[model samples]
Target: MEERTDMPSDPTAVDPYGCGCTECLTGEYIPLERATEVHIADMLAGRLRNHTGTTFHLTADYTIEPNTTLPELTPERLTITCPDHELTWTLATPRHRPLEDHHRAGPSLEYSDGSARVVPRHRLPS
Candidate 1:
């Protein structure tokens, strides 16, 4: 992927139509676990953009997991998936006000045919 000089250095600076971010312009994939709630919130708020130059809205759902904290505390899970694309991510976070979720995004890096190559989202055929 070719790096674009006009891309936004900060993710927040990019619009919902994710054309100006390094991920969108350069097809750089970041681990979902490294993503924060702010990133998910941005997606929910039509602030997070995808490589397609469009806003991707993420849906939040509650799930049950092993409670490692207090007995009264429960772990919450947030799953984000793109309906029109092969994109899915999950964030395991605490059920508190200041929620910090773990998530991973971007296309698959594993591609085997005869050579080693990573096919970016934009490079995929429609």
Candidate 2:
């Protein structure tokens, strides 16, 4: 994948269709996780964006590992491990507020086909 420095970092900016529920309003909400998964799914589905343009029909062989638990947070934090490579990310609830629903941010992801790739919370195209 080509690197584009101008890519948006905010999840909402990249994915317009959020988790579609209250599960996304707090910290790394379900909406965010779903959005992230959608991106990976798109990649696997061969739906690749220009990374610099609005064209959204690219193809690539990809795999997405669901969120796993990080050793640091143990049973509290939501972490996902990618067995394909050495990468892990933690999802925490918004500061001070507890998750209203069972919703929580899924694990952070790292993709390693040849290079290391971290899927941003946003930047997932529909």
Candidate 3:
């Protein structure tokens, strides 16, 4: 599907609604990890702004696969699906913190046909 021209292109410019993360709550966007995830979630949210039937699926694995070419690196990704559009962002820089407990009540979630199930991947139980 074609993109909406009326939508804002810059993700950082967005001040999201009631972000519960420490980074957004405290406004202490630290060097990496937490701060970075906040940005990513906002960015994904921006892309899905006006699209109907949007599904945001997050993953627990932030491992970047081996890559010799800096530009062609395959890192962890955040994917968004809409009724007629899909965007998968390959994050060159993912989490630096330990994968186990860094993020999650639902560390990983799987989605198909709009149904979701939490995948407990070494995450903090909620």
Candidate 4:
């Protein structure tokens, strides 16, 4: 008699790119560059709201100074942790073109902390 072992057979489980996982559930196309922008915007907004008691509206064209150091996006989702606030945010790239880009470009987001992420536009939900 031969002993048999059970193995997981999900494609997402075996995916090398880290797509098809729960972390990447959105299945959106977000490039690395774009995702970072979102994260920075969110962090700045939170800080302003918390410390100054004022709400700041974020625009896509917001500029991130070249001196700022942020995390790089991976094939899987990006997680950013803010040391000051101890907040963690998971960013998913937009699958479609950003509304401001005439629906032809992907968008990215950044969370609190110094982490940033981007997903390509084509990966977004149709």
Candidate 5:
């Protein structure tokens, strides 16, 4: 069963884009630059072990998706672990948000079921 989340509201937000998809938040029209969409759609990461940094093993693969049957105060979508660095992070996908106008021009969600690509083993640490 799909559950509705009790999302926090930002009193200062002014949204003007949305695509009426079952998986996407609805949008309106706007003349503002679309850059803000990335920041808004950013995954909320929660550190579980060591601190976060870009200096992780290049081979450290990560996945992000919700795999729960929610009863959550703060929903966790997925976890990413860097075994080499002994570091971990949990992430939550965006919800109750609006999609940008340009998003409708192409794929609804391109990486919906995609894997991340990184350099091959030849270039990564052993």
Candidate 6:
């Protein structure tokens, strides 16, 4: 069965982005940078755990420096725990581009099928 709630008079009021509608008194929106970070981290960790459980850690280091980048498709400092080693990996400044962009560029990680997978350096073409 499907249930439906009446649409609010000011639809933006219920929107998390809070488009300045009259009823949007305190709606909050997730900045692009933060959203990108969370999405990447969650998807990456899940895929690592599934494919490389021996090396992936659920509590591995994951952080986003809000002060370093604007909420756009720009590079931001990112550090992620390696899946097959005892060391951490640093993207230095991972751009907030779509997962496809990163995958195509052949970074240390790739995102696809709603998950992020690791791509080894050796896999890259000369």
TM-score of every model? 0.33, 0.22, 0.27, 0.22, 0.19, 0.21
As a whole number from 0 to 100, the lDDT of residue 122 in candidate 2 is 32
- lDDT, candidate 2, equals 0.32
Report clash pairs, candidate 1: 32-103, 32-104, 33-103, 33-104
Candidate 6 residue 19 Cα shift, in angstroms, is 53
Model 6 RMSD in Å is 16.8
Candidate 2 runs further than 4 Å off: 1-75, 94-100, 103-126
The backbone clash count of each candidate, in order, is 4, 5, 0, 28, 5, 0
| Candidate 3 TM-score over all chains jointly | 0.27
lDDT of 5 by residue, 1-126 (tens): 875454332212222223233222322212112213222222111111111222422222223347632222122133444464454443343342222321333112111233211111122344
What lDDT does each candidate get?
0.40, 0.32, 0.36, 0.35, 0.27, 0.37
- TM-score, model 5 to reference: 0.19
The residue-by-residue lDDT of candidate 4 on 2-115, one tens digit each, is 643443221111111223444234322222222233534444433211221223332232223465322221234444444433344455433333334433554434343544
Model 4 scores a C-alpha lDDT of 0.35
lDDT of candidate 3 over 17-95, digit per residue (tens): 3345554344433222232333444444342232123344544334455653333332244443222234333332233
Better of 2 and 3 by lDDT: 3
Comparing 2 with 5 on lDDT, the higher-scoring candidate is: 2
**Best of the candidates, lDDT:** 1
**Candidate RMSDs in order:** 14.9, 16.8, 15.0, 15.2, 18.9, 16.8
* Model 6, span 42-92: residue lDDT tens: 345442222222343333123456664322233344555545444343433
lDDT of 1 by residue, 1-126 (tens): 975686554464233322344564443423333434455434444455432443345444544457533333323545665445445555444344222212112322222332222222233444
Candidate 6, which segments miss by more than 4 Å at Cα?
1-50, 54-70, 73-75, 82-85, 92-126
Off by over 4 Å in 4: 1-74, 93-107, 110-117, 120-126
Comparing candidate 1 with candidate 4, which one achieves the higher TM-score?
Answer: 1
In candidate 5, list every pair of residues with a backbone clash: 17-27, 17-28, 18-26, 18-27, 18-28
